[model samples]
Target: MAGTATHHGIPLRSGSGLSYRFDPGALGFELLPTGGPDWMARYEVLHTPEDLRRWVGQSRLDPTPEPEIGAEDVPAARALRDALWRIGLARVAGEGPADADLATLNAAAARPPLVPVIGQDGAAGWAAPATGAQVLSTVARDAIAVLTGPYADRIRICSGDNCALMYVDTSRPGRRRWCAMENCGNRHKVRAHRARQSGE
Candidate 1:
């Protein structure tokens, strides 16, 4: 999870050893890598309360909160994540998300989210002893915002081969196509270059 020097996003390493930044452009999309529904279960990383807490720490949540995680929170988090996955992918495909998936997101969003407060030092911080439910509620709310907001039409799946990662095209021109220019984008460029050379 080394941070990419040039990108304002999470760093990820491919199986082939290519490391690059991955900005899902929204917090909710971050949960996709923890695992997914059905066939994606093999990538499961949230197996315990600590695992969920670790994810929270690594997430893009600014001024990260140390939530009081409980055993039950793990399954709840997974359910929300799975719902997000389905909904996000549906958006990429220009299809409507399932009613059940929407229900799950709404349910999570209904919970109390993390309470933000100013510290004595005049710094922004979360209220003490936040619960995992609160953290999840915040994530769900973010998903709702991204799915229904102005950039809703900008949702895109990376065009890189074998890459299913989703991201919002926040670029000014909205022409972004890969998960990261240093990774997939570079690979695509190299392949195209080699193809041209061989044809010559």
Candidate 2:
């Protein structure tokens, strides 16, 4: 999140204590911004096989320990991320997601993300090895549901400074802008106060 450089052609941001943006339940699209900028200097979280494993855990897509993630999993995950970003951006712009992106997403959705099983005491839970491909599929399925679901219209890009994170504006007025008040919202308020004092 601090250092700037390139890794395997993708921009890498490295620093201690760098954390992911927002809570997991806030938005499924948060993974796309993991690398950094959507266009330039993006630090791909799925850059390595290990990164892929960590991403699955971080996303909470599956807590099950995954088998070895291969080199191929990285690109597959990145492709899914890109497609989700495009689809989300299109919705924000009042346009429909492209056919190609939809197709890609649908394909992934068709795959079984995880197995279901009855747990102790008759409770149900998902079970799986949490392989790399399955993780990507889970994310794709989430994106598809969000884009096609009722709340899709409420999605918006965060208005915070230098923040490209996307989120659902569940505010009552539906006029929410920043991803979170503690992060970008406070920054905006501070800037506005400075401007007011400067004018006085």
Candidate 3:
């Protein structure tokens, strides 16, 4: 009732200092991951060190149960994992018209007219199936719903520094200071202090 929601495998919290848990349903993946941008980006969000220890560790993807992927031509497995999480770590939602973000995500996830995939190019030898991709897309849309729904107004990206991490503002007046009081909040405070000292 009072826990954070998992967004595309990333844990989005409601209140500060509140802990997180894991859910593979949030990851949008059935097996694990290979390479490529899609897999890489998703991997990044789900496998960060601290995040792994917190949420992902509890999930099924923590140790990577060795999916049969021997394709060296594919993206680097180890690097893809790290890269994806780093990029996702930079998830900072913007304000102004919240509906815009919501709308965009919704549109991307909007159900397309149901049509049968007739094989990649009629060759039938190796036609990429849309079933898996389609399901994954749907899961991604659900992830966005997790981030923006319920408390769209209170959700915000940190404006304290160059960082862009998303955080829910839980201050009394709804004017939260930073992405996290321990990270950007403290950094901004230190910068302000040095500026004042030099000025004085």
Using lDDT as the measure, the top candidate is: 1
Q: Which digits, one per residue and each the tens of the lDDT, describe model 2 over residues 127-162?
A: 655466665666677777777777778888889767
Candidate 3 lDDT by residue in tens digits, 1-200: 11112233333342344433312233322112322244335433333333322332243332222122223312222232333223233333232434433443454356431122333354221122323223323334544553455543554556765544444454568777665555556667899999999999
What candidate 3 gets wrong by more than 4 Å, as runs, is 2-54, 58-150
- Taking every candidate in turn, the Cα RMSD to the unseen true structure, in Å, is 3.7, 7.6, 13.2
> Which pairs clash in model 1?
none
Off by over 4 Å in 2: 1-20, 24-27, 36-38, 116-125
TM-scores of all predicted structures: 0.91, 0.77, 0.37
TM-score, model 3 to reference? 0.37
Candidate-wise lDDT, in order: 0.83, 0.63, 0.37
- The runs of at least 3 residues in candidate 1 whose Cα sits more than 4 Å from the true structure, single-residue gaps closed, are 1-7
C-alpha lDDT of candidate 2 relative to the true structure: 0.63
- Ten-residue segment with the worst summed lDDT in candidate 3? 123-132
**Overall local distance difference test of candidate 3:** 0.37
| Candidates ranked, most accurate by TM-score first | 1, 2, 3
Indicate whether candidate 1 or candidate 3 has the larger lDDT: 1
